[model samples]
Target chain A: MSNSTSNTPEKDHKSSYRAEERRTLSSGEEEFFFDVKTSDMEVNMGPQHPATHGVMRVLIRCDGELVTGSQVHLGYLHRCAEKIGENVEWLQYLPYTDRYDYLAAMNNNLGYSMAVEALMPGLEIPRRAVLLRTINVELNRIASHLVAYGTYGLDIGAITPFLYAFREREWIQALFEKICGARLTYSYIRIGGVFNDAPPGWLKEVGHFCDVFEEKWKEYRDLLALNHIFIKRTAHVGVIPKDMAIDFGLTGPMLRGSGVDFDLRRDMPYMAYGEAYEAGAFKVPVGSGEKGELGDSWDRFYVRVEEMMESIKLVRWCLGVIEDGPIIGEIPKVIKVPAGEAYVGIENPRGELGHYVHSDGGKVAVRCRVRGPSFTNIAVVEELMPGTLLADSVAIIGSTDIVIGETDR
Target chain B: MELQAIHDTLKAAGVVGLLGCDEPRPANKKEKDPGRAGMPFLLVDPAEIVPLLTACRDESRLQFDLLIDLTASDPAADGDDLWVLIQLLSLKYRHRLAIKAHLPKSALSIASATAVYRAANWHERECSEMFGITFEGHPDPRKILLPDDWKGFPLRKDYEFPTEYHGISCE
Candidate 1:
């Protein structure tokens, strides 16, 4: 199909397509000439495109069939979350965090609450609350990763894997609903601890979920992870170097996929993670390129798969150690954080979610800033996008697993 | 490196304009938060920011390689002029340090950190558009989270909510 038979399909498709496009565009009897500016194009990939997964537009420039460069345009969903945080009471701000990373709302809640807690007097979390939080947040992480995995499958040509992943996610949502009232935006993780303690038999149900999920995880892997086409689309595409990943401030799986052994849960060891990590049973799996180039789209995709398994392991551990006690901490009804600033970062499913709170000894904060992980992580797409074919760019974006809620917020 | 050691090194290196640790801690919650606990920040002269941050990144022991965040706060209770907090993290030693610099309302500008950390590009852009502080040498300093012709910096405590944006009633 190439203009010359001397070229391979991979290298020649673009030339052939461009030639065909030119022939069609200038085919009239009237005189016509090929123009490079008209031939070479810039494509806007959406504030509404399904592939974008949320309200975001990617401005991509293409030479023939290959993308030459790109830029990310966000803020379509900017609700001024920070400005609202400054106006609302401390407790009223919890629900707004829910909408930031809606897929990982619990983690967002936990991160924001912890930042506020840093400003409180005598704010040490209880052991029982820690264990409960470890369970709930890790469960939320599993649910978040399920969305990422399922949608990545959707981004690729697979339909059934989305069903499989969502079926499991539904189970987790039901469990979360039993403990907290809502499913999607469950503002369960309050400032001091969880909104409430787990109901009786909830931990046993988690154990059951983990046991059944392990076998299903293998089947899900067999369906897509080992599929040759999935491998072809992702492997060796969007390769990122470790130093570049660090310089761009990618955290969580995005950083780990590039072979960085840094996870705030393990490194900083907040909540119940310190003891679990100290026991030496916790595992941090970096990209070994088991099936693709290091830090490629496949490596990023695989890291999420492996992290889901780790979340299950964490849930099991928390269930084993959880003790009976008060879930809520003794925070004052009319909360007045001291006049100062506090910043705290927690490992969300997407990456490092940090909350910065500046209070002027008032009922509401002076400024509540969020360093959304997806906001920073999404910036690396431009570095990975150029020189890749248009199709592969979709794979890279999907592999990064960003919720545009976090990106645009 | 311990914070005290990093503080001593900054002092010994003869970087001027750093306020001492006796600036009456921010509202007595210092005993709980570690980063700002006894957080003695260097009030770097605006002209010397690039060199100070570059040293923090390249220094052998206190390699503050990660630019955690670059944010501007109105700090309304303290001053009319806004303050910018440049947070740096050292991956080598697992320590974090803060650099505080203030910008007056008349000329709200400071040297950009993009030359030192590429991650600063977007954060700096966001900070500039939201708080109206100019990142002097940022490669592409455009309004990131707002419309290009947006009238005011929304994050400043005194910023009034617009009654309308481009003829659409916002009130």
Candidate 2:
């Protein structure tokens, strides 16, 4: 090009560009190219995002990759279940309870039924019905924890565990379907007792499922619970102290995961759990920080995984103590609950699900208040999200295992 | 501890505004009315809620460290007062207590329990929005389960269901 006379214009342009660059560098103006001015950017996750297991929105403010602040906006799935409870009769509210925590409908059913039954002083739940209720509730707890385990793995970018977890969960759902007509929202546990007795061979099938699940449980532990990359991403990520756990009103696995050996089923037993606890059928598994700090994300996830096995033990115990008898109490078709108010709290898979029913000697309840565990458990995310990375925020939210339907209801 | 013992302990602590205990009574043959057969609850003055809860939590014999649930209920469509219910649990002693504060509907406001337990923050917000009760010193008193510009308190007995919201039918 230098030898070619026709390329003079090209040579002039190249020389001028090089001279400009040299002059700018000599003048100390190159910092403008390397320096970046930043402000906190607000990012909205969910009401539709996948990380949020349901329709919940989290507004997060980030400085680069660090989360500086967060605000959780709920009510997206509010159906006013409390109001419906006030309007419906005593027995009609059971189906409404199933919608709050759809994944653990049996637990919700048990909670509401127990609360209403508390008012009927003369009502008696048959022995066989109590055993059946225990079996169904414990099995549902396993199914609920399986979802928590699977989705938490999915949140941490492990896909195989979710498939394995759901495969087992589906088997549980099928057992429920065989007993009741509906699979997802069975509403099987009624006010006095259960809707019906288990179908023939169903209990034996449950025993078989327990045997198979014990083998698959080991595979699940190896696949995701002990994976190196999963541990690195989750362990020590969102550590909540024991004081904070109690201060926030957290219960169930959330409280136990903080190394607080308080299980409502054992401490305040209900629905034959007291008998089961006395029988030494199962043990409460508290987080010991096996891989990281106690109350961290992995600790909470591990607690749920361990709880599934504990629930299996509980189901097996129920099967061992089964007897043939009536499956329901003698509840009137048109129920008229005595004039009184009772608050019955049962140990749901997530936490203490309390039902406060106030009656004025009428067919309908004057006030029906539900103390949803997911509602209280999810509130701590606001305190946990700040000072975490954007990716770890997902881990913390997933660890809470909140169903938005329960949160909003 | 039994309900009587807990109440005696609270009374001994010089806790002001103790309105005595409401015991359970079964339905009688003569009255034919199913009497209050539910769990006994302590009735306290709304103004002294903070002190009452503080005493319940701090007393050596009665260490109610966990605030299990906080909610409010309206008795009737035309009731004169709303009852604010607070359930407390002690992890150390494994005893539970239920305290109800009678807030007159004419003045539906009370001291927020958030000072005693941080868990009360969200519970107070929910009570405030649903029952139209004003928690005097709550940090964040925003509407929790309802929209920002909701028309009326939905949980109140006298609340009227709205026909539409934002061009969408609610009925």
Candidate 3:
């Protein structure tokens, strides 16, 4: 790596001309021309680049083709959601949750709703609303994981699967559009209940989707999971051990991939989760290989695939047993709760989306903080990246399934 | 474990003397015991947090391996004490202990839990940056979410949002 070899004549001419100009200016003084050495190479992966998936700037320090080190610069998309949450009313803030993790808006909605609902004891949300919420949220989870698995393949060399994943995702989005007015940011969930009841034949459409998803899921696995190139790209890369995963406070599939058998829905059931119908239907099955090694990119990928299958099963179950009833719970027009603090954690698509809310016996919450799983997942990148190659870093990041919106929120 | 037994154990350990254990809130909410029998809550000084956590971790009955969540709240409207809440969960006992340390907002200094739990590194960093609380022993204490040159702690009640920093106007 020689700095003196000027590759382009234009750059060399400009450099020499600047040097000559400086020399002419310092003719009357004794000046020392200290040499300034640049690095071996530097690349800006972007605040605008496509592979970054969001407005993230990663400055990569490379020696030849290998990455020496890297620094992640976030906040390009920061909206100060916590501050915004404080300014808005409890119900008004429900719409903003959708923007936090736009990929899985329903999970975000459910997390905030559950936290608020926890404060108000004896608020009975109808069975239909709970079932509707479960179905839509599972659909959103499938859509989110599809984007994760598909874009992950796109992050690597495989481009065809990205379209395939998007095609399936569009179907789910269509169902969401039918239920809610919006597609991506469906703020369908209310504080006590949902915005509205499910439309006519909505359950049938979801049931039809569940019927078709099993076959489509196999196609997804065949396109990427069985592909030798993708396996070579991801396997044994970005392995976060069980202890390290726990120490880093990693959750969701990332923690489960490291063999931690903790799922919030299964471990600590909340909001009609442990009911007899939901117990048999909506359980998330953990993925396992022959040797039972959990901490690998393959395990993470397979877990998301298995989770999608489980989510489909859950949606089918919810549609069959759902009964028509009042969506909103009985409460005063102006909602007020006793002064107390409650922390609620829901299993979002990426990980545990925890909300810690403190109320001062008023309509407004005193303090609310979201414990985003993406934040913890992204923190372990420094631990995972040291020994891996430059290209593999993208795979590791994608496999980690980080949404910078959620992380930087 | 019964609440009285838990209180008795803490009293036996000599932790009750430092913080006055006079009036305990009864486990039964209806019982009006103004000056109760035992300490319902233990108030450990900010400096003694690490040692107390270590003791709790090492104790046979209280093997608190998980530092569940750490948060800072402004309890007083007059901007008095910054209440730091630390929730520790023991996997062995399946019990949770909530420890709160009240410090003046001006001097928001507390010992870091990095040595006890590695997960506390980021949690403490977030708390420190957001609430203007300084975790004394944290290795990398620089701003986590906010920019290095950020003017004020945004989460604090008294924080004023700046229009600009480093000649970049936020407006």
Q: Highest lDDT among the candidates is held by which one?
A: 2
Highest-scoring model, TM-score: 2
- The list of candidate 1 runs beyond 4 A from truth reads A1-38, B13-17, B21-42
Clash number for each model: 0, 0, 0
List, residue by residue over A1-409, the lDDT tens digit for candidate 2: 0111111011111101221232222223432321443576999999898899999999998766656688899989999998999999988888999999999999999999999998888889999999999999999999999999999999878888899899999999999999998888989999898978989999999999999999999898888888877887777767788988988989889999999999888887888889998999889999988777788888999999999999999999999999999989998898988888888888888898999999998899999999999999998888887656688889889999999889998
**In candidate 1, residue A8 scores what lDDT?**
11
Model 1 Cα lDDT, one tens digit per residue, A1-409: 1112211122211212343333321113321332444456899999887778998999989876667678888888888998898889998999999999999988998999888887775676777888888888888888898888888989987888999999999999999999998999998888888877778888899899999999999987888877777887777677777888888878879989988877888877788898887766468778877665577777888888888888888888887777887877787788877655677888999888988787766799877889898988898887777656788878888989999888778
**Candidate 3 chain B least-lDDT 10 residues:** B32-41
DockQ, computed on Cα atoms, for candidate 1: 0.38
User: What are the lDDT figures for the candidates, one per model?
Assistant: 0.79, 0.87, 0.72
Worst 10 residues of 1 chain A by lDDT: A1-10
Q: 1 or 3: which has the higher DockQ?
A: 1
The DockQ assigned to candidate 3 is 0.20
Q: TM-score of each candidate?
A: 0.90, 0.93, 0.83
Better of 1 and 2 by TM-score: 2
DockQ score, prediction 2: 0.68
Any runs in candidate 2 off by more than 4 Å, and if so which? A1-37, B169-171
Error of 2 at A173 (Å): 0.4
Ranking by TM-score: 2, 1, 3
True-structure lDDT of candidate 3: 0.72
Against the native complex, each candidate's DockQ, computed on alpha carbons, is: 0.38, 0.68, 0.20
